[model samples]
Target: MKLDESALAATTNDLTREVDARGVADLIEFRMDQADDPLEQLAAYDGELPIIATNRARWFGGKASDTGRLDDLFSASRYDAVEFVDIELETVRAKEWLAHEFRENDVQLIISHHDFEETPDRDVLDAIIEQCAEFGDVAKVAVFPQNQGDTLTLLEAVNDATNRGIDVAGISMGEIGSHTRVIGHLYGSKLGYAPLLADDNDYAPGQIPLEKLASLIELTKNERVDGQVIDTIRSEVSVPKELTLSD
Candidate 1:
């Protein structure tokens, strides 16, 4: 299904974690760069959760080598379990060939931006998100926030983008801005990602533990509303299991 509403995703490199993530996260992000036998795992996947395939490049803060990385992701994106694919906005915009290929595979896209240094100002954030929205089905921006103000700026950008009807996910990394991952969904951030495995926090800093995030989403499930920011609410998030490929 389309990422048309608020949802949480468990970010992991292990396919086995998918079953455990059910009833909590709406999606499982399979990190091909980190997984051993990634394609072999994909071919064997019989789990319940739908997958969001990601083979992050080294330039994008991932361990994957530059050579054949896109080719690997290309192969991953076509798997039966994968419904969404996360590609860097830079990569897609540079050639945009992958974006077109993903479309032909009948998979949705999440064009993401990452700022490992610090969060950009509102205008730059908006511009990046807007450009991503133009290139794919969802626009995702993940940045390291130096302080509370930086987190606030990211939130405002998420709110503005959501009100403008863009499917987006806003993540403020590190301990300082970790709260945004949970509260972002309340502001119409279409996706919230949490640690899927025990050591997964190294890849995604300051992430809420998967189970805790699930509880938080469950507690606030009734508070989910539509088309508003902050004080408003969104409807209940989709049941994660319901989106499984087996269905």
Candidate 2:
């Protein structure tokens, strides 16, 4: 599935409420690691929303702890509904075998890394983006921002990566850095993630509801109708695959 010119939101639950409410073309994230029976859930999911599977590891603030986590991820990619799979940069760098396996499966990979502590310096962030770009279809980085400067740093990284023709999703976590979600898209971020349910059960810090984010992005794009803002927003919302699954 292609990820271009459309808003793809996230759904934590196995339901399709978020996708329906926001009128988004895709669901950018489904935290498989958090599910009791991830494979079963995937198998039973007949909802009209394409999924981007993510079984993040504990090192990356995810609940997956089994030694065979990577193996499970590789298997999940085989599911026809899974258009994109998020693999941590650490795993991609350490496990060359898994990297090749993803390539062999013809599954799109999103090499991601999260820093819950603090955002890195400009050069450091750039280097990380470069490394992830080498291996995955999209290079994603989520960093915690201590202050406004840290948020700006993330914007710079997102802009720089997109300027260099790299597909990137950059965000700053935490209360102080929440606005990065909207601004990131303006700065050329290819994707944004919002909760399926806008309640307190969201997986990420400072995440807004899918509908709100879609509205905000639309408003921002409308305000800046010139340049590639409209195209970028459109790209962020398009779904590469059909949402329905046949039995």
Candidate 3:
């Protein structure tokens, strides 16, 4: 299923809940590296949210080893439910053949880069994003913020990309940069990831619980509307058990 970046941001659930609280996520990024049996879990998922699968390598802040990593990813892409798959640009750049495989499968690709240390200069950031965009539908960059300025740089990158008609998800890690998670959409970020639970450590650097993040995104979006903000009415919808892979 196709996804709306803003709407998806508002309806995300980090942890298991009795009801599917968050309406829909921009895209549910299932960190396959953390799942013991990712394929099995995907096969059994009864949620309405579309998935963006990632099996990151340890070298790139993921637990999965190099061996079998691509194989597992290829298997997951075949699932009807997965809308996109996050693949590191480094990997695609080295193995150009992998990009061809993704294209043949008709899977939407997110070329991603994670910098745990510090943000880079605007020129450097532009170069990285440009390179990644050449290989995927969207380009994502996450950087560790050393100060508030770093966060501004991230926003600038997002804005620049958006103006260029490029879909980008740019985030700055660390406390001061946390606000970027909410404001990212304003700058044309196509995806925002937050855990279902506050303490869930699935992602590194910066993360807020799904509920809190959803609330914030809603408020921000509402504030942008010219009229008075009204309480968002909740809807009752059953979660689907399986998602069919599509072209």
**Model 2 global lDDT (CA atoms, 0 to 1):** 0.80
**After TM-score superposition, what is the CA distance of residue 165 in candidate 1 from its true location, in Å?**
0.6
Q: What are the per-residue Cα lDDT tens digits for candidate 3 across 158-215?
A: 8998899887888887787899998999999888877655334557666777778888
Global CA lDDT computed for model 3? 0.77
* Superposed Cα deviation of residue 157, candidate 3 (Å): 0.9
Q: What local lDDT score does residue 189 receive in model 1, on the 0 to 100 scale?
A: 93
Model 2: residue 228 alpha-carbon error in angstroms: 17
lDDT of 1 by residue, 1-247 (tens): 7776787888888897687888888899888888899999999999989899988988988878989888888888888789998899999989877789878888889999999999998999999999999999999999999989999999999999999999989999999998888788888899988877474446777888889987877677666565566324334444577577675
Evaluated against the true structure, the overall lDDT of model 1 is 0.87
TM-score of each candidate?
Answer: 0.87, 0.85, 0.83
Clashing pairs in 1: 224-233, 224-234, 224-235, 225-233, 225-234, 225-235
Q: TM-score for model 2?
A: 0.85
Task: For residues 101-186, write the lDDT of model 2, one tens digit per residue.
Answer: 87777778889989999999999999999999998989999999999999999999999899899999999998988888877788
| RMSD in Å for all candidates | 12.1, 13.2, 14.2
Instruction: TM-score for candidate 3, please give it.
Output: 0.83
**Pick by lDDT: which candidate is best?**
1
